[model samples]
Target chain A: MTNTENAPSGAEIRLEEVTKRYSGTASPAVASVTMTIPPGKTVIFVGPSGCGKTTTMKMINRLIEPTSGRISIDDRDVLDIDPDKLRRTIGYAIQQAGLFPHMTVAQNIGMVPSLLRWNKKKLAERVEEMLDLVGLDSAVFHDRYPRQLSGGQQQRVGVARALAADPPVLLMDEPFGAVDPITRGNLQDELMRLQSELHKTIVFVTHDFDEAVKLGDRIAVLGEQSKILQYDTPEAILQNPADDTVAGFVGAGASLKQLTLLRVRDVELKQEAITARPDETVEAVRRQLEERNRPFALVLDERDRPARWVHKRQLAQASSLRTAGKPIGDFVSTQSTLQDALEACLAEGGAAVVTKERGRYAGTIDIDTVMATVQRLRDEAGVSE
Target chain B: MNQFFEFVGQRWGSLLFDLYQHGSLVLQCTVLAVVIGVGIGIAVYSSPGGSAIATALTSAILTIPSFALFGLFIPVLGLGVQPAVITLTLYALLPIVRNTIVGLANIDPAVTGAARGIGMHRLGVLTRIELRLAWPSILAGTRVSVQMLMGIAAIAAFAKGPGLGGSIFSGLAAIGSKTAVDRALAGTIGIVVLALVVDGLLVLLGRFTTSPGVRARA
Candidate 1:
């Protein structure tokens, strides 16, 4: 089996004057639209229903042919290639997972690889590898049918199937829309992690702006007739939407949504947060807090995991640091978004949010630091908000 | 019942041979109908006009009376199993074709779209995805056709076709004879038993061939 780790980097996709007008319709579903998708980055086509976002994405793989204009992958015209061959080279996944019911999880994942005529051993190995990549235990899931798995698991298999043949380009249309909100968030994170490793040129279509902002490296905010109002980085789109339509799509809570785009680790952590070990005496912790002139100290367990926050006043009244400190109600991880960190701070009613790495205390981000990072990003992007 | 048993004991060999003939004729006609019906079904199901035309034509064939239908075939194909088989095959086509169309049409468009989107050519999508998902419905049609043909094959005896239908028509011709009731009773019992056996086998076939995922819906 060929190792996907050695898979080629994504190919650039370009659309020039692309237009699709259904017969008997006065207006083209997709008017003359042009955009260039950089290799190895995720670009999203986001718009409301009937905005032709899905039609535009399908045109890339030739699932829906453009009535006029040209689409090319890596400078090669898609029209020049047979659609079946073109589709095999470009992975596609859609909502409801669309897994073949008669096939087991392994067969579904190995479909593209099998189409490429990989041998039994190679196909089996690829299926197992894909199952593992999607965080499913191959032994438990490979033999199971799609109906036997939960909605989230089926979507994971859908993604695994799309990546089976190591296609350099992937097109996903509302892939996680059918799953629950929590599952959707997890799947989005999984895709982000996979993208970081695979670097496949991906065209993602979704009506959800939050999803677009979270997953897309660049977002194409589309309007009626598939017009791209703004084609820029998520930060740029969030900071400065092109027009009222784009801003309306961005909708309320723009600042909160912007926080989701920045990770907790994106900002430098303030390490001045004094800490006391769980086994430490309250008197000693109080003395350390007094010496540092800090009102509170974050308590750490034996393994250096964040335990609680010890205040000077609480320590003065209690027998030990472990007993005096308030229980750690919420914490954020390095991989967690700034929005998560802010939420943690708000939930804990604390000025700072503690960061954990694999259950071990990493550092702390104060509310001021989070706001500063947000302000800095806005300023860098030349947006007042 | 005692008279029927006595008749069977007196001519057990001939009776068994007649049962075999009856089974074989029904099997042959059903197999032919399945092949042609499913073929036509797959061909036309993709198009609304074609499906409607195919369905209408087959239903029109079904409305023909069995005696008249078999008689019409006799003039062209001659009086024997050929006419019997042809009439039964014609009768069988309607159910199988209609069910095949329904089964294939009922498949979720997303399923077909996904198959095509993932690079399956038209033929591959049909064979691997659509047909597989539609198997239960198709098999159901076949079962209905087979049962319907089992009874029709008996009527084929009027065309001098194979099966216990000969015993039935002959016995009916001589109603008061000692063996008349016995012969007709055996034929009728054999047809009912054969239908049950064939239906059971079809149910088993459905269970065995259908994928666990598709079957799980039930």
Candidate 2:
């Protein structure tokens, strides 16, 4: 991952003392912002409305010229390059897709490549390839105009158009802000999948903290005048906000949101629970539970999968382990999110059974373990509860 | 009516010639007006002050009575096609210029921004994106101009310009003479019939030229 500094697919962007002062304005629009965006990472700029988050992202591609600052990409000064030529090399996508109404989907996607004077045959191939990459069927969508498509479909075309030329850097300004929540989630997932393979240096701007956490590899929480409150991984930001403003932006369910970021596999499972075959006599299970000094024991079936939970008191009414205690109601796999684990743990009202491949009894995650895991994350982030 | 029909049959050759000239005059003037109007629109659409001035000037020309316009042009330019072309083209400019300005101004800035974001230069955005999207409005303006010009070109004949207006004026001058009413009715009917045909052709042109995405809305 350290070699990502010179990743072939994307180029690093650096902004140094970038400030934009609109004439007659008392304060600069973006006042002295400096940050280095690593190559091949989706770095998000999240902030409240009119906080200059969008203005910062736009400056990267020179859409809004920085009044006085040096901005460089891959160590080459962006201001040195011709603005239009530089823009052609940087992919840009915005909300509502902004596709040309007169052009078909293929035309919109092919515009930049065609501008670069790619030959007709190659340009045509690239358009089809781009459409396919964005999960659009060329046969159906290639000839269709932007208005003919649905909102989500239009956004897909917008993304496809931006990526058509395979620019090393992509600047997205709230690209998913206009879509319905459900479609927006699907689009975010699709973008994540695309980024995994493409690895373009993406500078995304959004006011939605949840969206930033969901999509960004590193989220830069911006404040007034494009101030960088916290520029770190989502995990770090959620667990430990930089200050009161950032914490307020993170909102009340910060730890709850943190749970969604973690998975069951990442945490230690409680594997020392006493277990017995369901066919064994309930007297032996009760004796084993007493020997282990535990209030309950898990009963495993023939193939060693979890079958039931036998309480110390329930063993008196049952003659055999087969008829002992109560059936295991719900369980989570090792791949489940900690949030899902917590839900399952709460539903079962005790230690939640953790399963591995094919529902085999793996271990357990009790309520205390779930609480402690979140506490451990907070501790690691140097943030107190 | 029977006398008008008999007169048309007798003067069919001359009437057809008048119709052709009337059509030619309207077509030429409309094309000229569109060229100038769209140019002014493109130049001024981005500037509120310029657009307002251009629109006001074109509209002022429209308020001038047609006969008075002909009289004003006659002293400097005299009669015939020169006055007719200038007068007719001037009168047609209001709709074309206004529509062009409105159409160009109405284009979504986001669309133009996206165009520039994708590497289109200033002229590229103007010709390829802004103009194309605003074309529907521009074309509608042209349609209105053409309709207005069809009637206005008849007035141009008062300055001794070519077209059916000459015949209508002659019929009025020769009132109570045999076939005078027939001649006047012939000129009136010919202009109406020819205006419809030209408008239909313009409609067909719109169908062919306009993008389906825009056409769907219209």
> What TM-score should be assigned to candidate 1?
0.96
User: For residues A1-385, could you state the per-residue lDDT of candidate 2 as single tens digits?
Assistant: 3444444468899999999999999999899999999999999999999999999998888888999988999999999999899999999999998999989898999999998999999999999999888899988998998888999999999999899888999999999999999999889989988998889999999999989988899999999999899999999898778899999999999998888787889899998889899777778888888887998889998988899998898987888888778999989999787988999999999679999888888899988888999888878777443
Candidate 2 residue B69 Cα shift, in angstroms, is 0.5
* TM-scores of the candidates in the order shown: 0.96, 0.87
What DockQ does each listed candidate score? Answer: 0.84, 0.65
Model 1 CA lDDT for position A129: 87
lDDT of 1 by residue, A1-385 (tens): 1335555579899999999999999999999999999998899999998899999999999999999999999999999999999999999999998999999999999998888899999989888888989999987998899889999999999999999998999999999999999999999999999998888999999999999999999999999999999999888888898999999999998888999988877888878888888787777878888887989888887888888887788887888766776888888898888888888877877555555666887787778888888888878888544
Full-model lDDT, candidate 2: 0.90
Docking class of 2: medium
For every candidate, the chain B TM-score is 0.96, 0.97
**Candidate 1's error at B205, in angstroms?**
2.1
lDDT of 1 at A345: 77
Best by lDDT: 2
